[model samples]
Target chain A: MRAATASVAAEVEDLRRRYGAREALAGVSFRVARGEIFGLLGPNGSGKTTLFKILATLLPATGGRVRLLGLDPAREARAIRRRLGVVFQHPGLDPKLTVLENLRHHGHLFGMRGRALAGRALALLGGLGLDDRAHERVETLSGGLARRVELAKALLPRPELLVLDEPSTGLDPGARRGFVAHLDRLRREDGVTVLLTTHLLEEAERCDRVGILDQGRLVALDTPGALKERVGGDVVVVHARDPEALRAGMRNKLGREPALVDGLLRLEHPRAPELVREVMEAFEDEVIAVSFGKPTIEDVFIRLTGRRLREGGPA
Target chain B: MMGLVLPVTTLWWREVVRFGRQRSRVVGAVAQPLVFWLLLGGGLSASFRPPGAPPGTGYLEYFYPGIIALVLLFTAIFATIATVEDRRTGFLQGVLVAPVGPWGIVLGQALGGTTLAVLQGGLFLLLAPALGLAVSPASVAAVLGVMVLVAFGLTGLGLAIAWRMDSTQGFHAIMNLILFPMWLLSGAFFPASGLPAWLEWAMRVNPMTYGVAALRHTLYLEVPVAAGAVPPLGPSLAVMGAFAVLAYLAAVRAAGRKAS
Candidate 1:
């Protein structure tokens, strides 16, 4: 049973959730393999939170099944809860409590106790670089340190499947790198399956596999490598004063069909380093700036959807 | 039983821990009621003659038990109404996902409030001697028991409301509209028997009325019953106990519901 459960950390089947007249999660489904970091990638209002809540067993779906650690969230929430560690998107620490006190109470809530519980809490805090700050109140900590404490609390239980919501929200670049690397270490050492939701493509890039959501539906699901490869070679983007004319001229004159997104001409070419000048010269006066490079997860989102992955966020 | 007791003890200890850290809240909750009792009781004692008063009983003496109930109410509100803050700050979200069930959570919260109310009420109990009120070991025990029930019922009511509230400002509005009215008409400030018919009925139905009546009865246990005694001791104790149990069950049920 352990081996069988080890292969699939979480499985979802056509999960649907409705909030009054609006459908939040409309027939979403995916499976996360054991020890893999799976990311649910979408911008705000794309049902990412709705999906996260359903998986957390905080909300019941209007339809379909959600199983985490081989247990149904609806039927076996308590059993799943014992094995599932969740870090919410918002700050969940008690501002008045010290870091160790917060973890002690959290452990008690999960039926943990005594010297062993203390041992585990200290171990987690030590691993997260919060050992020295153990006696400090959570409200006094910086955003990055507080986030690390939250992770320590979530990791204290040694959950088989760990779920986080926008785990990189308040962390600086270096802290974000360390956080993911810590999660990667958890996967390697403990075979813990990790899932996180993010609106930023860069954050999604850290996941082993990503499920792209749009308008309450799963648009795509694949490895980051596979998702980018779908765009093929390099993507050349041309910012032009007359984007429509530039796009038309690229297709009509150069026999090149480039997708127009956010008023920019986007062409996925096998040899974009050489094709950059061709597209720029083709619309010499019309083009303001031309760039070509390895296709990012953003380019894949544009190739798949006709819109940018995020409105505004750091790359 | 450790499953239930451990969570309850830890949560109750958490409330005490949090209370110790917040000095302003302690002063507000403990001292605010003392000021209210002194000013209100002093001003009203003159020419305030309700039926069933021992011929020479002053309003301050009469309102003494009522003020203890008020202190319990304040402490109950102080301790448990922060559930809205915890919810707003997202800490409650973390608790909800834990392995503990809703019933355990509710019990922990309700008991936490009860402990603080009992403690604060106990502090006021010490002042009873200065007020010329008698205190035997028996009366002290009796008051603590009744205060526990009264505090538990009040805190559970707060829990039922707080678990659903997303903001503390909204909670304060509701507290003023609902909780204050309940305390005011519970025969805390006045006598129930001497009231007009409809007002009498409202007082009789208010659960805190039974709590205050029980406290008064226990404090005045050695004394003879006056003509205008409220609800008698037996019925008051029964009603208050039932209220505590019923309110707790309601809070647990409310917490189990899916919050948006």
Candidate 2:
């Protein structure tokens, strides 16, 4: 039964959600395999939040079908809620409650009690490296530490699927790494399927599979490596004094125009080294700087959406 | 049934714990009403005597039950205000996603508010002797029971409003526009008799009037016959009970809705 159910932990088929006339999720569809970390990557207003709320059973979709753990969210939301753990982007812990109290509250919400509940709460705290701070109120804890408590509370019920929204939003680099390591361990040992939505490219890159969303549509869905590979070669960027003039010159000489994004000349070429050298030498006076490197997830997003992942890129 | 009970009790416990942690709220909800009672009841006692009371009845004594009702009202408002903050802090989101139904969640919150209101009101009841009013154990128990029912209804009314409010400012607007008027016209501040027809009618229709009347009737449990304008104990209790149920259902319905 585990293997059979493990085939698909969550599935969305042509899921569409709208707010009146405005479409938030336009026919978005994807399947999350059990034990895999699947991420929905998008920029602001890209509808990832709308999708997250729908999956969390907080918002009803205007149209389409969503199934979590083989149960429809519309009809069997309570059943889905029982097996699903959610970590919201904002702080969900009650500032007045201690870390242990928050975990205990979460346990009781799921009908766990007595020594069983107490044992589960303590075990989760210990596992999350929060044993020493369990008695401290969440208001007194640091941002990263509070986030860990939130995760521990979510895990109190031992959910089969853990859904997080921008899980590493406020964490520093070290804390972010620690949080990711915990997720990795959970996936490996407990076979828990993790679903998250994020705008950070690095965060998305670490996921097992990522679905890129732009303006309410999923543009590209694949492993980070595969998405980057789709760009197929080095990414060459040219910051010239006159990008239009240089583009014209490059078009005449190289017989191709580089994609102009955020006022920079960008090109994905199989042999970018020769291309960069030739462009620099050919337009030495016009070119200020030339750079080329392997494609990153940001480049993949740019290649697909024709926009920078982060709005308002540097000139 | 056990599954539903856990979430309700857990939510209820959180409400009480949160209220206990905020000492300022205790002073605001309990002490503030006491000051209101002392100032208003004292100021009015020398100038006017309540109509239709026994020969020696003063404004202070007439207003005592009203003050208890005010304590319950104030505590309910303070407790339900947390619902707005819960939404802001994303705590409500966590509860919404839990496996429990809206009925359990709202019941927990309503009961939590009711507990705080009753505790504060009961604390105020301790001052009853200082005012030269004597009460038996039976009257005291009846007063507490009346307080619980009244607080539950008031808290439910507050929840029905707070759940749909996006900001505390909006809630304050509602408190001023609706809640304050409800309290004032409920015969808590003054006697309902000898008023304009419309004002008298407002008090007659206001559900909280029955709550205050019930407190008065139960507080004077020793009185062989009721004074003027105090509704019968049985009918007042019935109204309070019906109001509690309807208000609680409204709160549950509000919880089940998508926030606009």
Candidate 3:
């Protein structure tokens, strides 16, 4: 038995990337433990992909040190890549090649050929439930199937560290679920350390530990429950007939005030239901409805950084 | 060693499989040179003759060797654009993140592009007889050897340029600016016999000039010794070898920077 490698799977320290006037990654530092599902959560332009690219040895940092399994990414990139598997956000499969051929080609890159290559490729396809579509051209597959193919390609070498950058972007709901489930299996069965980046809060919650990246800084890093708990106070959202007036009434009654932005009154209070009932009783005619719940990752994000995860999108 | 071979071979095979799927690219690769041979060679044949030309020889024969050089040039240059596309599409990232070193990517691409160039160059030989040019078995083999060297040299140069270019638009613009000057200055389309002293000097220094001269020497069964032409197959091959080494180094460096 090859003794289980105890070294860190990935480590980035004081990493910074500058694109002319803009800083893509600014002093970003993080470490992913061996065999952990680490999630890099951030919205667009928050430097999630940039950080992942640096860890994958695909991009250089302006000033930082990156080590993958004790190998320097800059000087020992090839050796690091041998033990690392990366699934890019975009579909990187060759469009002309079939799914199985894509995996075979990827396997060949790692030095596997002939029956060994073919057997592993087929087994991966079967494991991914893509056996029937093995012969189909990658261009002919749907977005979700193509993403699955990308995953299968990444797993062909059985790499110790699997890096996925927004692996579920174009995937439908079912496909996303299946993909996550498959990744979970990879973590559980194969003991592969997964480093993934995503903008989806729910997906980030599924990770063993989530790192919240906002504007090139890791604002929060912990398990989902711990992060939500840190925010404190259950989230009390008041949907009133006149949000401004109700917000004023609640502010006047509670004397503690709440965050009022874009017609939603959000308050973090220990007795959120009591506060909601007190506000509703005080403004019986003005209040329309009250919804109370424990703070979710989204609320945590909103509280930490005065914006929702999908702020501009359809709520 | 197996680690190196495995990734390089994989990337090379992927490129070949991709080339096989694009029918139009194949046609463009083989057809463009033949068209240049027929149209430009025929048009020049009527009015233009070799300075100390032999009687009864058509313009196609004189232009045939140049067309082979052109074929190699076009294939190699277009392959550079494919590299740019691969980079833009993130496929290059996947390749870079593989176990193979940066040099492996450069070598694999150069080898794959050179193979395609050779395949296209071979088709030109089959079309030679139809153009009233005779190709003996020896000449065919020698021409193929020159084609390999020229293709490898040009592929290295293309990979170097593609690695330097940040965007496809920038790559295409640079290609347009360099392609015509390099082609015309190399004397691929015309003889350098009557060119200005400076222009002839440029041709003498141009790598493509050596490639064209060597290829023409084998294809036309004539000693390549123009006024400013670098004589002997040895010197020309040396220039190409130098280019291959320099371009390969640049490619490896650029790939390393990008991968870093």
Model 1, A22-138: lDDT tens digits are 998889989999999999998788899989988888998898888888887878898888898999999999999999999999999888899999999999989888889999999
Q: Report the backbone clash tally of model 3.
A: 1
Ranking by lDDT: 2, 1, 3
lDDT of 1 at B6: 75
Chain B, per-candidate TM-score: 0.95, 0.97, 0.92
What tens digits encode model 3's per-residue C-alpha lDDT throughout B157-215?
88888988867777666677886578777767777788889998988888888887778
Model 1 Cα displacement at B148 (Å)? 0.3
Question: What global local distance difference test value does model 3 have?
Answer: 0.82
Docking class of 2: medium
Candidate 3, residue A136: the lDDT equals: 98
lDDT of 2 by residue, A1-315 (tens): 667655898988899998889999999999999999999999899999999998888888887888899888878888899999999999999999999899889889998899999898888889888889989999999999999999998888999999999999999988988898899999999999999999887788889999999999999999999999999699999998989988998899878779888888999889998888888778889988888899988899999988898878542
Candidate 3, residue B248: Cα displacement in angstroms equals 2.0
Give the CA lDDT, 0 to 100, for residue A310 in model 2: 84
lDDT of 1 by residue, B164-214 (tens): 776777777787988898899998898876568999898878999999989
Clashing pairs in 1: none
